[model samples]
Target: MDGISDVAVGVKRGSDQLSTYKNTISGTDCMNDGASNGSDSKKLKVDAAPPSRVLHIRKVPSEVSDAELIALGLPFGKVTNILTLKGKNQAFLEMGTEEAAITMVNYYNSVPPSVRNMPIFIQYSNHKELKTDSSNQQTRAVLPAVSTVPSLSSDNQEAAGTSPVLRIVIDNLFYPVTLDVLQQIFSKFGTVMKIITFTKNNQFQALLQYSEPAHAQQAKQALDCQNIYNSCCTLHIDFSKLVNLNVKYNNDKSRDYTRPELPTGDGQHSLDSAVAAALRKDSSLLGALNPLSAAAVVAAGKVALAGQPGVLLVSNLNEEMVTPQSLFTFFGVYGDVQRVKILYNKKDSALVQMSDCNQAQLAMSHLNGQKMYGNVIRVTLSKHQTVALPRDGLDVQGLTKDYANSPLHRFKKPGSKNFQNIFPPSATLHLSNIPQNVTEDDLQLLFTNTGGTVKAFKFFQDHKMALIQMSTVEEAIQALIDLHNYSMGGNQHLRVSFSKSSI
Candidate 1:
């Protein structure tokens, strides 16, 4: 493959050169296009890209497989190769020519996107745009920090277009929707400004406000026909009907809107509780390491950043013994442990965030690879930088939101110093000695493109393991076949595999 090389060369160079290694630290390598040859191969033909062009696309789906990216991006021309970064939600679409790259960018930017559920941002990569000392200098144009939390108010800020928001009507409401449940469902839309439920005879009427009309419409679309608590508890949704609060109390629209089949405590229900049980049954589900208590893990992660508003990881604690929330108190001693993260499997391994760069440096100078919980507690900064603060910890809303708007919104440097190995494990992909030009996103995108339909993709805070999820198991096998010794971008061959996940 001409104009193509992968990570092996860079990984080897990195590990060999850096006495001070940190997966969290990003590196870059200028093109050493030594492998491009004029070959008559069709595979090479389909894969060959112009000797010198790069595509810059944003607002791509996170779940979109690397194959899909190739499919979507290749239309611009044989993408000699494409790369996306997991740290931020964006991709580096290197095309056959600057013309091709520019053509692709303008083509997409001309109209509303095909898969876009939200607004999209994209453009060409100008060399002069890059900043100094940053591994991800290519897409260095500042973007909004990753945030998916829907707005809290329902007012139509947009006097124009909007997505639909689901309309919900509750029937057998023995109790009004609690704040916990309200936050759970409404937050998914954006943010909830207000929720009100009134009851007279165990039956309740409720009004829910979502950030956008589209979100309300979507909620109505999916949940309208679905049951709420269980199969026996059917839910009714009304989209066109809203009580005219301006007029006197009205009973017609409210009652006719929907009906619920109430339960008679002793009655048998058809729904199985199996799904809930299954999720709870597996404690080692998320990744190799159990994440610390949601609250604590986020706090430690935040503090590790030294006041930068972003997500954090906690390490150096066992799920079987101590609770992640409790262990975070110890991190608080270092500073405001914004968030704490515990690995699902790497017991005692944790990640913590401080309030500012100085604090993060303090913890790093004092705590990198410190021993704790029968294992060494690794402490370092995180790469999940964001321009704006997220709505909350856990990064759930942020990750989803980043996936929606633009893939580039995914990475931010608010420039917090990234925490390296808070919990370094023996079983990990050791990528180092990278030319100070290689980036975490570059490495991740390489494997994902070659790896097939990545089901879930994550760069391990740094580069320990880029956990991949495939559309099907077969793609994983195929990726393995094609990747053995195959090289890309920086004269580097990739290390690809299917192993234990973040769990």
Candidate 2:
């Protein structure tokens, strides 16, 4: 009876051990399943936040402006309104539609927010839309942008009814499309008879009369939907009902092509007394305004300050990309480039002397801190009055006729075979048929300033041929696209192509 009791106790102990082992396996499985579900729940939290149209972007770089914010949204969709608190490092952007906002949020959230080298964070705002002051908005009703070419469309029979009188409405008003700019662009189509600029419904509208209706049509067809320079000044042109544009007055708002008083922007122009007085008054009031108003005034002040003349020191340049002529081309856009001296002591730096301090200031304000040839161009006033030219290297003095003549004018005389001619981008660009006067630095300057990083440069035994190595295949392609058939001095058109062997 005692032996039977011992066997029964041992069996009871074995049963308890089996139970404990089963419990341990069950707890471990529960933990493994919980961990997987936890990860899924986190991902759901990110994806399931109810899609919102309005995004409240936080942690924005303080230096970021409203324009930069608008630019960020441009890739996704049209941005209706942008409010930036530079001091607070936050911004609110209103997209054209809800879908656009959602798309932008989804894409950016998955990635990271970065602008101007500053990391940013974007999230949905509690408010569906941003509230803006009606008084603050520059409510202008400009002409609507024509999406399709109605004039050239087959369905429209009136396409042939060209009119010499063209009513030009600038599609984009954010750009400072001035009277002189219109005259220069329209002049290519035909002799612009006269121009009158007026603000209608808060939009910039202009009346341009050409010598012939055919010329007006040609200009409209060519320039319509095309940006003037960079990307801002888009032209939306149409034929006017009137046969001729009347020029009743000669003032800031109107300019007759026949009038000699109109400035050609050749560094000889000055603001009238009335405009000057208004600017001075506004400058005095800069301290009292809010953050938004202050930012606008500051930008205006920069342009106004650019009118001052002095020597501008440009640094942080890719030595392969910078050249005296390229510097002349860029700075000349703002003011007259009197002289350009690439520093021999510092090959990566240079000094550009503008005609006056105003021009120097303007160049510095616009071109300073801008990316050129994979580097931010550092523009500042030089302590020395002028840059001393090196005896050995090339120095550009006075304005090149191409630059002094017009703003961003390339490929002069339309319909030249050069218009259709194109050279694909490559890593190593082969250059031939170069002019004797054009130095290696000149060629390098042309490529780098126009979005290229020169990795290597070589001239063959034949001085006319040279090989330029860009930092990447894409940069080489851009150089080839921009410089092919480019007139270097003495009627020499640049011959550019890709080299099979990497230099």
Candidate 3:
């Protein structure tokens, strides 16, 4: 330990100060060498053991742990001990034998190892064995190296390469693949830093960033040409020229896994208020709070809309059930539907282009995550401003040729009254003031004749309120206008508005 001194002295300090400490220890060693008497005890034989089976790592992240270091080395061979110089962001990892150390060094020396995206330089340590002192032992949390950090090395170390970002394109998009779905898929290789989903050339495209390029390469190789669900969402992968992805919004399309949020349906309530509401009412009330009508919620959500494009990314359809006409039948309710293109490479997904962003936003906020055809669909503002149909090939045949002036469009239809009293459209409509004995079929019949097509109908547990998912935003708005304050039965005045939940 001649060149090393006071490993514990600067454990809580930074790297620059630790360098100065090392210089001081070097000066002390030189002085001791000059002052030493010619004693036989000080002399050692030349045939001492070679360097120990330890690898020295430098430039590590300060937050990285002993367990993480063990995880890194465990793939090559058994790890014997770990010494962490916390403040300096360095460590010495001792493997079970010198051969193990050589294997680790030769492999990672040409390509460096990384933890948390920070590249770490590795070399052989001179020590024959790590010293286990009480102070150092007390400071570290040691675990057997047999276990692995699933996030770090689910694949071989060779796949944990140097680049950190990957660009992924869905060749065939049939499933409703959300940012959450991509995160779940790519995270097995390494820590996923960020993911951004958008539509390019009418296809679902995404950018995924891992902590290291090797992880990205591994994920790309494993998932390329793989289907997300039942051979529909085929993945096409490549290395991004950019080293990292910049994510500014935590919206439907972009997610940074370094900072993750709660699931999709759980955003309506705060922690304290949710508990309070649960205590006040039955636990069922804790599911999703609906204080305002769906129209009001849609109106509120519009203020945050980027107003970027008419294109909408639709997800979560049953590939077995969703078709170009089915998408048109639903999205056409909100605005003049221009075109519908079912992505050939993805399962249960399609692109619906409206005449304007207003209609797209109206449709997105209302119908997102609403049940249709036995599956809940998720809709979001696509990064593409419009759906550009392929100029050549059979894909163009999937486009809706005459959607602009189609009779199916609510406003363009003959004698359509929706133009005068247009509320912000939503798919889920809230209906209150219902008679206790009234059934779902009765309410469905009332709306189907005037409001629009009914996709789903469900009464609240109390039977006084219900949520109805109309086929389109216009229908929900028409129903809201027609039914608000209308008589139901026996002094009951019906109150209807757009609902927040599509169920």
Encode model 2's per-residue lDDT on 143-222: one tens digit a residue. Answer: 01111112344433365364576666554332245554565445544456677665433234677777666667766666
Query: Candidate 1: which stretches are off by over 4 Å?
Result: 1-167, 173-176, 240-503
- Sort by TM-score, best first: 3, 2, 1
Regions of model 3 farther than 4 Å from truth: 1-307, 391-393, 396-402, 412-503
lDDT value, residue 428 of candidate 2: 81
TM-score attained by model 1? 0.19
Clash numbers, per candidate: 115, 17, 20
| Candidate 2 segments exceeding 4 Å error | 1-49, 133-225, 228-503
Which candidate number would show the highest TM-score if scored against the true structure? 3
Task: Provide TM-scores for the models.
Answer: 0.19, 0.29, 0.31
lDDT of 3 at 300: 11
| Candidate 1: tens digits of C-alpha lDDT, residues 1-503 | 10111122322232233222223223321122111121212111123233236544445555443333433333333333445443344445445456555555655555444322333334544331222235443232111111122343445344212422223444422112332233333333333333433321223334554545655654444344333332212345543233111111212111111111222222122112442233233222111112221111111111122223233444554445444344333343223445444543464554455544544443443334433333444454465442233456755422212211221110123322222222211112223223335565665565468545544555555453355545544454344434433454476544443342342
Model 3, span 1-503: residue lDDT tens: 11011111222232332333332222211222211332223322223234568776666677765545555564355555566665445677777778767766765755467665556666666566654444334322232212122344555455445457666766433224566456545644555677766643334567778777776775666555555544344566766555666555556666554443324322221123332332234211112112131111111112123234788999887888666766775666566788887777786788889878767865774467566665667787776767776766656546434366664465565344443223334678777779988888888998888737999888889999899988876566556555656678898877665444557
RMSD to the hidden true structure, all candidates = 27.4, 28.0, 21.5
Worst 10 residues of 3 by lDDT: 1-10
